[model samples]
Target: MNLANIQDFGAVNDDFTNNSVSIQKTIDYCAALGGGKVVIPAGKPYLSGPFNLKSNIELHLEHGAVLKAYPDESVYTKSAFRQNMGEGTIWIGGENLNQISITGGGTLDGNGIFFMGDELHDSYELKPFETIDPRPHILTLVSCKNVKMHGITVSNAAYWALHFIGCYDVSIANISIYNNIKVRNSDGIDLDHCQNVRISNCHIESGDDCICLKNRREYEELGPCKNIVIANCTLISTSCAIKIGSENMDAISHVTFNNCIITGSCRGIGIQNRDEGTVSDIIFSNIMVECKQFSEVWWGMAEPIYITAYPRASHDHKDAGWRLKPGAKEAGIGKVSNITFANIRCKSENGIFLGAASPDLLDNIRFNDIDLEVSKTTEYQGGYYDCRPCKDDDFVGEQTAGFYMINAQNVYISNTTVNWGTQKPAYYGNALYAENITPLILDNFNGTAAFEHLESIVKKGKTQLEKIAN
Candidate 1:
């Protein structure tokens, strides 16, 4: 149990040399002697390509230390794990290890901008590659147990910041992720088929989903995603702030999020079931949300709370991939049930939406003590429902409603209120718009339809269109 320093093992912090081999040797020496601490001391930055993490080894970085990634792409290597995110390249990884922790209040810079291409408009397009994407993920820990990562700043990942696949008993706290908002696909904290995870007291800003949970198609043997708790976190993103499953091929359940704040994001608290995975027993409570419509370059369309079940790329999809085995007909059949949201507040250009493929596909949804306000907060166009990567149109041009529910069953709203801004558009209408819902209950609902002041609280039947469909 020796405390090894990287400098002693030939890792000089020159900021020009590829110190990956030196870092790897130091880690190996510590791990070979029954595991210990390896310190990247606070000095000049250490530029490195990639290295493997060891079991029972604490990779501690001092307060001013920075372990930065080398920009060159050819020095990186692909993963050996089968079907784990298509075996992508990774920066720091540990497979089948236990008690692996990355601690100390330092930074891990991914140097993501070096891997991007010229900017068209909203975002920088990724550089074209021959095979799979060559961008290295910042961190990938596969099937590791008792993992701890805290007091660190992870910035500018070309891909996902922290990806834990099929791992268990993970605890992440007091860390900050600052992925550039214009960098597409730079996600933060992706939990794929992980269990017993707790994430608290963190701040994340990203271009993609801040925190996403899914069970990918090829990783079905890892089992369902369950028992995740996230609290006291602030999230900002260009896509959904917190999301579950656009790539889920298995089941996800028993997830809870509380006391989180989202500001100026595209979407918040999204449950998107696009594949065969069934989603149930998810609860979000005591959260504040403020979202706006970004340009069509991003995934979401400003819904504060969006829950939808759609197929991933049906035959009707204009940009369908080469392999569409299910075709458009048998795309999304996952049942989403027992979802609840409580004590929430939202301010957004758009409203809350709960749409499903069928009435039976979504059930037992509840909203309690919700306060929502809709306003014209952005120049981006509103009044369109975004169901991207679906069988039909990616965006459905529906009239904006404070709370729109369609193709659902057993939905209950209690003590919820809605308010429209003074300078709202003509496209906004209806405090509660319902279509194809069974037994929808409204208890103590207090709000009028936007601009219309409709006499009926719950409006059904024919709807109003803001503009003609494109």
Candidate 2:
């Protein structure tokens, strides 16, 4: 491969000098020469502003090399393609490209603290523009195909660390990302409206969701995100560790998460369909989770597994001076069905929550060979379920259950076990609680209590419960 070194283009190793132009020149030179490797050598740190990547190019960094973003906001601008969800600038990005790769053992630092402003510690409300400054995402690939990212360490992102929007045939492996827990909106990796993606052997620690999948809001015409596989990853986050939806405008299907470890997260394995999308054929297996409640600054309530399908409100669409107009054709509410969670071992403060909004019901969900333990040693004891249109203001009373289901259909729990902590609070009562459900099946459900007590632990409201004979 042709080698284009940035050092040859007058890019200094000093961290102070802005290396944006030099790096861009090297990348352009490599692309002009029929695409090759643009190498950043080791020894010192190089600082730069936003730069675009080109097709058929490999941006390779040697060991001990650092490519850090320049902290000044004036050096960067919004992308011309306007492919991103938020107003955040793109630090290192590419659009409408093919066969691009980023492979390195070096570090890419965002210098996010410089842009986050002074009031960083406060629980900044999550309004569209009220929370923080217009910080940039570290790396974004938009509408690209045949992308590969591996063996890189990305840290301290101001917003989402790595975002892939409308990309296909992507493979990401052996990467590490560490964002501060105090940093808001610092999601680890977002796969938006992409297909045939495989992510494996990564370690991610972030303040927000660790790994998230979304159907693009602006590019709903691109279709759904499908055939994604994420395995052999270690994740730690204040928000959900693995999530699908929460911004889905189209279908998202055929996704799987396997052989993963999730720790210190507020939620694990969440599917939140808020728009008129259909999310189905999802699976999570052979996972271990250790989750606990965090302060009110975060959104989740330490639920080990939470799935919900709800209609999106107008206010939910209004973010960053942008509003998704209500569709004139009356799209039906979102649907979540054919989901399976098996071979999961979880220690959580909160329990599994399955909720569906009005006129829609969660369908055909299954949990098999799972073991869950609920601990009482948490700071937040609200014990309330967080469903759509039900904020903290609508909390009726304390909740007491290992599994809470509402407005669901054809849910099957087989070979699952629940363990309640000895110090059960007054709010803790049943092992299973169902409301407005139909055809809920329990097969070989074992708990710490006796079989009779465990059977009594099931509390139902307007639900047809079935205990399958083992």
Which stretches of candidate 2 lie above 4 Å from their native place? 79-86, 119-133, 316-323, 326-332, 388-397, 448-455
In model 1, pairs of residues that clash are none
Per-residue lDDT of candidate 1, residues 1-470 (tens digit): 58999999898776579999999999999999989998988977899999999999999999999998888888766752343323347899889999999999889988888888987667888787765566788999988999999899999888888999999999999999999888888899999989999999999999899999998654577888999999999999999999997877788999999999999899988998888889999999999999998889898889999998877776555333422333344455588999999999999999899887778888989899999999988887788788887776788757788888778888888888989988688888888788877777777877788865563255454322221111
Q: What is the TM-score of each candidate against the true structure?
A: 0.93, 0.92
Error of 2 at 41 (Å): 1.7
Give stretches of model 1 more than 4 Å off.
79-88, 315-332, 453-470
Best by TM-score: 1
**What is the model-wide C-alpha lDDT for candidate 1?**
0.85
lDDT of each: 0.85, 0.80
Question: Per-residue CA lDDT of candidate 2, range 1-470, in tens?
Answer: 88998999989977689999999999999999889999988887899988899999999988888898896877767742265435577899998999999998888888877776445443333334442335778998988999999999999988889999899999999999998767788899999989999999999998889999987566666778999999999999988899887777788999999999999898888897766778999999999998887776676787899988765544433331222334432224578999999999998877788887641458999999989888766767657755432211323225756887778988899999888866676666567877777888899987643123344345556788888854
Query: Cα RMSDs of all predictions?
Result: 4.4, 3.1
